[model samples]
Target: MRWLVNHKQRLIITVVFYFVVLLLISMRKNSMYKYSTETYTMYNISSSLVVSDPTGTFRAKLPVSHAFINSVYYYPTSKSLGENAIAFTMAIDHHSNNMGHHTFNVLGYNSTNMIKSVATAQTEGISRCQYTTMMARTNTLSRLEKIEIESNGVSVEVPFKLARYTAPKPVIICISPQFAAEQWQLFVMHVHAANRFGGHLHIYLTSIIESYFELMKEYERQGYITLDYWLRMKFANPRTPYFEPNQNVEWRNQAGAQTDCLLQYKEAAEYIAFFDMDDILFPRDFPTYLEEFNAVLHANPGKNYLFYGRREHEFVKASTLSEFSFTELVQSLRSSQTVKRGKVVVRPEAYNSTWIHNSKHVSFATSVQVSSPTLVHVQLPVDKNGKRNHSRDLWKIEFGPLIEKIREDDIKAIEEDIYR
Candidate 1:
């Protein structure tokens, strides 16, 4: 009994040591495990179409849930309305391949058991082509309901929660004179069409060669071009003109005839979009680009500033005898719109100085440098006939699929315009 009482202090010390060790191990596990609150939006469609959320437009395609008769998307239940609306664009893709009927739907719900609201639209036949469409309530929706879309053999139910809506910012276009004058003219036409249809566009035109001065004057006179500013030097050479600033215009010293001229002007807005003079802008769905831009900006505001368009380039051998042979390029262009691998970093500062060396050439400087939230890069339709009927003698690389969005009611009308 005397020995037991004498060892009581040593026994207590042993127990305390083991408890401290266990506590340290528990702390390490808690630090090692972290849960990300990052959420995403997915479109629940009735048709067998590719749907995705660009909230984080990573180059690698993220896994998306597809809704069959019984399967549905449940992850986006608590996301905000801005994070919930599916950016849907219709296309002619799978027309020749799938050759099946399909319908499109956007659904929202708080949970799998509870049904919210389902926005459904049916698109049928090889006659319907792919174009940009927004999945939103014609009227405001309260709390997420159940969404059901019926098309072809597929019926999809997507459950999404009702979060507050975030309106998209305006699109700012960077236009350089290096693009063909005729193509620029066509671009202006598309810009006008975009402004009238869905969203607003700000055009930044940098005069490189003196040849475009006349065209600029004409555009300005027509109200399509707004002069922001100009620069002048004390000893003006015959080749250069004096710098002038107009309230509607902003100008700077000429950096010579470099391609970076328009890129420098990217600072004019929160999101800078690129379009060659020859690219065509579709009538609607332009707001989706801005919405994607705004979402990225919201997530990584003041962190990054580079944006690039995801496009499919088609190389075709043209017959030297006929300009009409080039019309086939449009078909080649449209076929390339499917999602592909490779990341597009949106660095406005880097994009201004660093040109894409070639397709598939992504360097670290552009990728790692300046930060920008990404926007959706929708592939546009290409004219296959190679008719070369347009102004640039170049085929139309449609830009509308990536930018402008059309009303659901206007989908058929826009498709008819493409055929006409």
Candidate 2:
């Protein structure tokens, strides 16, 4: 009886061992990708989605412990370089926390397999905008499926968006907390001028006012504008309150906005012109932006950008939508004055990171300096013959183009009734 009991016990042990082995094998086949690395003490949150704004907008996703990280991005750097790699752009505080305690991470996926990586090869933008960029170059192989970014303790999953690089269409990137509901007239004129010169506006609205939403949508529908909204979250700065501005918030995250545009839209456009909304780049002699850039490229061999000088526009003939045309901006163009600073029109693939005034990691640093294609920075608004008009309702001229059309119809109807 003792021998039979022992035999049964042995049989049970063998079966249990086989069952455990089979279970492990099955799990190994279906598990996420794993590597030996130091993972932080994670109180894991629910996974997030691909990083994009569905209703034509974008907002910052910051870490729970800190608000330093702006975004993580990837480009097939092998297109420009000879290796597969990813580029990261974080809009952290420029003063104290530019590098963000080195806690940010990227989780990449290929269908079901996950590849988590530590950001590497850092580049920090040194600008007075209080907020700047912390860029990284990490080697990667997986395709952009679902991307999750973690900084400090918080991890956010953002929607994935695919964009194309059309070598012919030059995109103008205007980083704004600078735009207001009050500047609708300037915005209208800027769009018309940029489009007429064969350029598309890729505007990032850091602080969105609802009044401008309809106007932005109008241009977006007309195919002249790519509107993106950014949420500032009432923080004076993205980084810890070190050199936080005591005044307005316009200059807060400009460095981050600039670098983010380069990474996000490098594949979307071949040439990118960086300037403020009011600092319009009016091309001279050449009909379109392509023609002007090509001419400059032909003139300056080995350079990847055209750095055009700027001019100051103090006033306009009228702020009325019909009266202030693209031609009017060109007519008021002041090119003779010596520009203190100029803006850049660059091939984004040639640079790894950027600032409001300059770009970093440029393989080709030599750029042509031209004086004709002036970026006219509108300093103030006036009515007639360059006189300041403080009472000008430039912002209140009823419904830009649409109202003008309505007014014309109303006038014709009145005249017809009188005659009849």
Assess the local accuracy of residue 249 in candidate 2 as a C-alpha lDDT between 0 and 100: 21
Model 2 misses residue 259 by how many Å? Answer: 1.8
TM-scores, each model vs. reference: 0.30, 0.64
Per-residue lDDT of 321-385 in model 2, one digit per residue for the tens?
44544444434433324355777788777766766667655543578777664676664555546
* TM-score between model 1 and native: 0.30
Candidate number with greatest TM-score: 2
Q: Give the clashing residue pairs of candidate 2, or none.
A: 49-158, 50-158, 50-159, 50-160, 51-158, 51-159
- In angstroms, the error of model 1 at 51 is 57
Runs in model 1 deviating more than 4 A are 1-170, 193-219, 227-268, 279-289, 299-303, 313-333, 337-420
